[model samples]
Target: MESIINTKILVVMTILALSTGLGSCKIVQFIFGDSLSDVGNNKYLSKSLANANLPWYGIDFGNGMPNGRFTNGRTVADIIGDKMGLPRPPAFLDPSLTEDIILENGVNYASGGGGILNDTGNLFIQKFSLDKQIELFQGTQELIRSKIGAKAAEKFFNGSNYVVALGSNDFINNYLLPVYRDSWTYTDSSFVAYLMDTLGGQLKLLYNLGARQVTVFGLGPMGCIPLQRVLSTTGDCQEKTNNLALSFNRAGQKLVNDLSKSLKNSSIKFGDAYEVVAGVINDPAKFGFNNSDSPCCSFGQIRPALTCIPASTLCEDRSKYVFWDEYHPSDKANEMIANEIIRKLGFLYVNGTNTPPPAPAPTHAHAHAPSPGS
Candidate 1:
């Protein structure tokens, strides 16, 4: 009787081990960054700067309800969520949601007007610093672990992908803004190094906390933002701003490379977001974008502080424009950018084995879906 009982216990243990191993194959995508990657986490936090609660923000999303996204419709995070076989990530602040939401589809900790440094947006007291955002992400993970087991948590982290899109605000809000410029005393190189080191340290922290895959975006061409264009003397891109962005991208790439070498078990991927976005800005015609300098919204000769309300004149065709407002890109442009990053992810993570399958032929309902070539 004792021998038979021991045999049953061994069988149960073996089955449990196999089940755990199989469950690890499921992927969970954890996204972190600024407005570009932010879906609606900012809306959950008590802050007036949050756009997820405003109208016209989700005009193109069918629901016509704002969910904290900065665009007229879905942002890149939504597209990436769909591609990863998960439902759109809910705002971390949605009062109705529970830990199950994150355990199933992951969570977003990104916020608008955020930066790597603490003092990036002092005026917006509600905005989260990059470090704070990471801390939130870790807290979410801890919640998941408590709900599930450590093995399950490891599987979720190991199979998941992380997407980060930021750095624009550091230039526009922190460095260029008169308030920060007057308060902080750092040269261009010094500032760049400080920001990069902080960002790099955060990335390492995420990995140490159990992130297996990560994609860090470099800064886009800051000089071409509608806000910057309006602020420039000749209504042209500011060369100094563009140069600063280039330096940041260069440093970001090096940091990603170093992290990849230092980490033993995980693969950290760096997306050339700088080049991808800069190409669209520099040669809009090549990417089916018509206007790259100014946005499709109302133009201000000095500051672009004008509102782009629904009553305002929207471009006849938003798909042709790269930017939808002073700072955010249109859904069409976001789709293109997301497709580019997806292709890059397939190349880097899949060992070039399985390319993203050709996007299905579009029907009228899904006309905005990316093409196979994308």
Candidate 2:
């Protein structure tokens, strides 16, 4: 009971902090999505290809040990949290994560290989799809309600921020794979429409769960990733795949704007990761990257390792390479992407309101931080 009071106190204090301009108060995040945003959720899955528990995965994380993040260091989500003075959300499946921790520091449910469609990652054997993620969040919502009653729980949940970075697997792992039924089920345009329809319902579910401030990241250049490039005979980006991503981003951007208005008091912003990361990929030197096509970690002669094995070739300077593996970016590239997205979204601020002074008013997400518990 005492622990519950402390939990409630923490929630109230955070709400008061945001409402009263207490800069020191911790901003918690409820994170979702896939490997890009996954901290360590996949590691907990028993039989999963969504694993990133091996060495060198988190070399730059804390003390040079893998912390379950797919990248070499922080993800785009991690860097964005740092910029906003928000705490790093622990993996939802972390044994150490309790109800107290959930309400306080928040939790990340993002899983590698997970996608909008449930069957998207069937090859992985185990993964939490977006629908599964929402179901898990409902459990978290229940825990919060138990701790501080329904009203206070609503206040806390509504005040907290949310981040969702997903949908990549729906293309590469699902629609593109001949083994999957979705490939033959829908054409390119129809597939994206199916994805958007699923994603739209997912976002609506989140809003129903008190997700007032959400950032839905747009897909980047899929054709330029090390995995996709290796498949190209000319060793160049596949423009056709890129155009498909643009189709999704176009419809996705519309969804963000539409949801922003429909979900009363909600601020659903679309992070323009497509343009930001493409800038780095197109002109690598401009962003301090020399080799954007090749991955920092390799499996020797193989274009893209399913996941880096123990015997994979490691690059001398991970920072110089744009990609860490076939699918994900290196720590340096993630930082570049995160910083640019932050600039566009504009959550960081010096004053109590936490608004970006230099950035243009974000046309997508809410420009001003919504009042806590408003």
Considering every candidate listed, which one attains the maximal lDDT? 2
List model 2 lDDT by residue over 1-374, tens digit each.
Answer: 99999999999988875553132244588888899999889999989887888865776666555678887778888888776767677999999998777766788999999999999988999889989999999999898788667877788788888998888899998998899999999999999999999899999999998999899988899989988998889989989789888998999999899999889999999987788788889899998878888887677996568676556767766777889889999878888888888888887632246642232111211122122222
TM-score of each: 0.83, 0.87
> Which window of 10 residues has the lowest lDDT sum in candidate 1?
358-367
- Worst lDDT window (10 residues) for model 2? 360-369
- Give the Å error, residue 26, model 2: 4.6
TM-score of 2: 0.87
Q: Which sections of candidate 1 miss by over 4 Å?
A: 1-24, 50-52, 181-184, 299-303, 345-374
lDDT of 1 by residue, 1-374 (tens): 99999999999987765444234354557777777767776776675463545544555665545557777666876765565564455656667657766755667778877888877866666777788878888888788788767877777777777877778788888888768862368787888898888888888898888887888876677888887888888988888898999999898888988989988877787666567888888899998878887766543343474335443445656677788778888787777777787787673333124444332211222234222123
Q: What is each predicted model's overall lDDT from 0 to 1? A: 0.71, 0.81
Each candidate's clash count: 1, 1
TM-score of 1: 0.83
Which parts of model 2 have CA positions greater than 4 angstroms off? Answer: 1-26, 349-374
